[model samples]
Target: MPLVNRDQKHYPGLAQTTNYNLSSFKAAEIITRDVVVIGGGSAGTYSAIAIKDKGKSVVFVEIKNRLRSRTETYKDPKSGRGIDIGVIVWYVTPRVGSEPNTTGAVFDLKTGRGLNAPPPNQTAIGIAFQIYTQQLLKYPELDAGMFLPDPAPDDLVMPFGQFASKYGIEAALPTMYSFGAGVGDILATPTVEVMRAWGLSLISSLQGGFLTTARHNNSELYGKAQTELLAAKSLLLRSRVVYTERSTSGVRLVVKTPTGNKLIKAKRLLITIPPKVEILKRFNLTTQETSVFKKFLNTGYYTSVVKNTGLPDTLSVTNFSPDSPYGIPKMPAVYTIGSSVYTPGLKLAFYGAPLTNVTSSLPAKTVKDAIIASIKRQQTANPANPTSFNQTTPTFAEYHSHAPFWLQAKAVDIKAGFYKKLYALQGIRSTFWTGGAWRAQDSSDIWRFTAEQVLPKVLKGL
Candidate 1:
């Protein structure tokens, strides 16, 4: 098993470039590698390490300087004893595990209803025990993070539909989770994502977060993976493929560097790139890959935004999700804005979401002011003091003047063929396959899949 550093949080980033004429630049170095992996996020890092373990030289590249896209911090103001933003981490559980006292309820997920038919007494605590045990397996420090007597040791206290009532609607749930009170879309995801978001949200006030070491950040894990690949001497930082020419001998890859350009002659290639068709088309992909790349060009994704609202000037509600907004389509219940995020009087990370054409798909805004207006509508106008709505935190997303409302805002979500074609592109050049959106979600999961499928296949004939 790949042992990731438990000390840090792995962050990813994607940036746009100013120099479009890079493709015309003169060349410099000549290098060779068994494999070349694009992207430096969780999957990219792990894939590089796994390939290196196969005894092949490799090269890894990134469009941005940093690994992660977003960072979290604290909100201003203070409560009597809680946090600055009122943010909390939440875990899912049945009735029995709440605390020193209080019964828990059990809802069968398969059936999606209360399961009180057969047994005389099947408490929710039974579930609490199962979750705690799972934690024990995932983390070595479980003993330090959990407490048995507390019923809510692993879950967040929820009063869903808070945003709905605040808006004087039948329910305010849509704005709370889907519209995200100006955060990211939290709809149509796997169960794990929902659980993780909820669990972290539940404990925001009490235990802080499922946080890693501050210094290491999550990059440490990827950094360690990079280290494992050191034997390959294949890492190419601050470099990019300017042009690729398929030659009679082999594939010739010309990459641009600060000092000069680099030419690499390779027997085979392995590429893991983003599903953005426009972005992928820039690279000199093979004919087969080019055809697939063109298809991806039409796809888009949603950029996420997370923010804090509903706070007194004197105290901010840190790490908290709004009551579930009733009617919104793609809002998330909770977002990981930050943890223990109290900085005298400033909120740290607030809102982020994928930006896409989905806004057009829904009955919202397609223009700027209209989008912001629609997004602002998603949140209640500050209940305690009606004027408080005007005093909300200024998030990065707001400054960009980008898509504000995230009801299916486009950024993360993509078309179906995008992933399938991306993965199939690997076969265009043997030993080359794309992962991430083409394969899986989690970094570790991507690594496992790559190692199982690609490695042995690459080694077979060679």
Candidate 2:
């Protein structure tokens, strides 16, 4: 890797702005690698591993103490059982492998009975899904990343509800809504965004094509990944980039860790973090990058494990609005409160809110309160057997905020080739980007995108 010098050219207007003198760092304080991967989530971890497999050196930096945000497993104190409050299911992929099929009961909260699709509706759903698949096939570029055409198609940019209605697939909205719980206001979302979230892999998962870890602990994969990176001495957890200097020749970063600051010089940088304006500003983003990133917005999605909930262990309660279109529940709502097969005494609740300026400001306590209140309201609404619904106060054992999730731009922006501009940012100043924002918000999809699309470009000169 080439080191930046005073005489070397840098990205215009972004040269040597940091207070730290580049030459003042001792050799011991400086670390050099072929690539530097930030944000130790699925994409970052996978990219680092892939780079190393190609016999290249890389450094992995993460703000969190651990890697992989979506696969969190909380152990019960008394029973020592692992409860997966985050990412309980994964699409069966060639790389990650699959597990035996498992089935769970879904009940309508209003009726307190099994939620089964009627035969006619089921037929309609099958036909609708076939049509939806056919439609998605027209845009094969979307399967990997945001490689849309120059002028985006109208059907793809329209609201998903309108798209469904136009295609006579409104019968599928209820199922899509249930599966796309964390996407927030799916019907209102653009068709392309909705397809990206609930794409082919997830559709396959709905047909018994998904898997969990053998122990039902999805975090196990990340644990193994951490072990590999630690063995290579290439991972820096609980670390953040304080400053960055990027140029056509290479990239340099000053990372703040627990012990001290370390200077990292690498041929390339891969950013897997959400490209929110506030987060990217720290990197000295170019004007063009800022203009593209500022339009990105995200929804609030949270998950938690609650105990002492009066719900039955065998039942999985899903929200259903009897009067709403396709029975889709309202926004800023608890999508489901259900028992997990791995955790007998506990229940997992998933709540999501639509995009808003204050979406990220909602306190975890408030979310927990809302979930419990929704549960109580559902219990009171069920008339089948009032005794079946207990009134015990539920306590949250574990909670995780997947906020700033499902990142996307407005439909108008997407139609105006926002993604084309976003993808064009790749390799700018030797920095590349990959994440749910750049691809589908799924672990398998992000991994595939990193491996197939971003990695090749990042490794080009290295």
Candidate 3:
């Protein structure tokens, strides 16, 4: 059992409510738990496990059958080996000695060969990196969450490109652009938003080294978590919240599971899902919460694994635009097409698009068409290339959407205390929040924030 917070004076309408009609779920089985965690992604999964470890009962709900969202593994039918297409690397603290020197070469589509040019100015890049990192260090809270000073510094709110020029870190723009992939138009993004994408942990990883799973399958981590949650009978896969009611005292939800609908009653509601108004409308959001969430904007990101790409396994193609600043390619475009490290003859393509509207979507066919066109353009640019897409069409083995990602607000809203109001929603109506949207968009960083900051507060309430 958990203690219910009875303080509802500050928030009116903090009483029983539901998005759907009560008569519809009269036969649903009622379930009770101390906490109900929605969206079994990185933050949700971690928080549920931590809550259970703290001697509290928790029920984890996920729309998908799997736990991890970004980490997707495509098993190659030929080799029977898992090829990690999403979230391939993670950062570890406390510098991990020296890393191997890796070389990158720009392949010329017109020439069908690697460009014979000098590498980027290492000295300039190093200096720019140092200055950029020092600037990020000034706001240490960004590593975990957006707990900025009341009056955020001008530098933090300014456009990242302006910040780069102001600090003479133009040499670092390309690097940042690469690191900030999936975040459309990094240079135009607010400085703080860019920092959230490429924050302190990533900087440390650059200085130290990145770690990947031994089996090259990042999903293994979540698989283990799923096993633990299943053993505790705290997980509900292939389930979605069809209706929810949150009051100051506690919360109740009607979840549509694969087996049947189940009514969940809990003292606290932890929503780790992306809090878009369209998604949260069913949660019976307060006027203030609705107003805050409606302002959030997010980018569209997708990943795919394909074969017969007409690209050599040795060649790595990076989208570039000489016209754009730092040669960053335009949005709604293919970011990269590279050979899979473990699976030869297979290529992975990453695509990113800017948010046009709240409901903007990028179709898989649209992405696949773009990739094919790009590959054909490359092969046609150089007729001498032996491989050609004239006969064979690239087969898309796997495609995953990571959209509604990199959630952020306009500069005006951020400066007008958007985060302050957003964070204030915690513990209100007996509901809490944590996820990439609430914190930095990194698994490790989100876990730290959930465990160290959010879970403590949640435990105290319980």
Candidate 4:
């Protein structure tokens, strides 16, 4: 059982020795551990357990009071059905006989349900895959071992738009970009970045197929993680790392929690959160680290459930203009929209526009309103059956911002080995890093990489 310093919350098997206050330690509560992990998302939670399994103590800190960051459950009173609000599906390819099946499917991790994917442009996907494979062969560093590079690959850079054109798969851009808001703008995105994200090989057959949320919704992943990680000595909920400092010997983090301030001392630190400039500023990063971090471009992706969208249930919304490259026909950009999101009236929307188009700093309501407006415009803008009709203004049922997602740099930065320098920071000043930026986006891939590659490095520091 792990030992907790405070008694504000209770875990099933942990010992909470809060009755005895250590006033002698300092003005604030001080707790020491072998490792400290920041962020409670898939990578951090998995890292904590993997490290603990290796016989090291860990302190898990999360700004939110939950283990899952984007996964949530939305319950509708009318139908009494709970639908997933975030982190829904895992893509996978099944097998036929002894060979792999070209067709893909979406598997629900929690429920073990498999939904067959629409027939993809195998010709287009094939060309892209072959090109990426040849690129990987040329530069082994670009290989996505399990999910992400153990150390990020450097100098492997090209825009997805360029890669597609080079391979005559520009026609398949629509199919490739169907992943919705999780992957921001596909055309302008980095080629290696896109390959790792929803790469044909990556999602083809890692675990035989994709996985999704159960009836309980997407929170199942986090719930399971929280249950497993409860044994960690220090699991600080509703906490934020207000200040941080590192030395050759160890790291010191000042955390603000619901209970009070906590001074956390640990031999190593694992940061799984997106390395935002504003957030990293608190960590006291070196000039080199700051320069590398600042180069990363963050996207604006938002997820939400809306009610009373005036558009017909038959139509879905996607954003495109006449100037869209390669003559790809306009299609629904919002991805999947289930009538059963929470109830029949509620529809889920994954809105992703460029940060330049929809700034990250915008409030959730503001973004939601913009999405509703876009939906309304899309309903009437179709040239095939253009009709101007005023429908009831849609309102948000719930909102979640998965923004600052897909952190990437320009082609020039990649050629400069920015990722190599970023990974070289590992064990420097006793700090390590992981997250979507470090690798692919899928939870399964992140967990696999964490177990196989990241934990071993973390163990070395411990």
CA-lDDT, candidates in order = 0.38, 0.80, 0.79, 0.63
Best by lDDT: 2
Error of 2 at 1 (Å): 25
The window of 10 residues in a row where model 4 has the poorest summed lDDT is 95-104
Off by over 4 Å in 1: 1-28, 66-216, 223-233, 246-250, 286-339, 342-380, 383-423
lDDT of 3: 0.79
Model 4, 122-156: lDDT tens digits are 77676755555555565444444322343334423
Residue 11, candidate 1: Cα error in Å is: 24
Q: Candidate 2, residues 128-187: lDDT per residue as tens digits? A: 998998888888888877777779989888989899999999888878887777777888
Worst 10 residues of 1 by lDDT: 404-413
Error of 4 at 199 (Å): 3.4
Q: TM-score of predicted model 4?
A: 0.78
Q: Summarize candidate 1's per-residue lDDT along 29-136 as a digit string, tens digits.
A: 567666666666555666667666667776776555544321211222243222212112122232221112112222222222223433322243334324433543
Q: Give candidate 4 regions above 4 Å deviation.
A: 1-28, 91-140, 145-156, 180-182, 200-208, 231-233, 312-323, 327-338, 355-360, 378-390
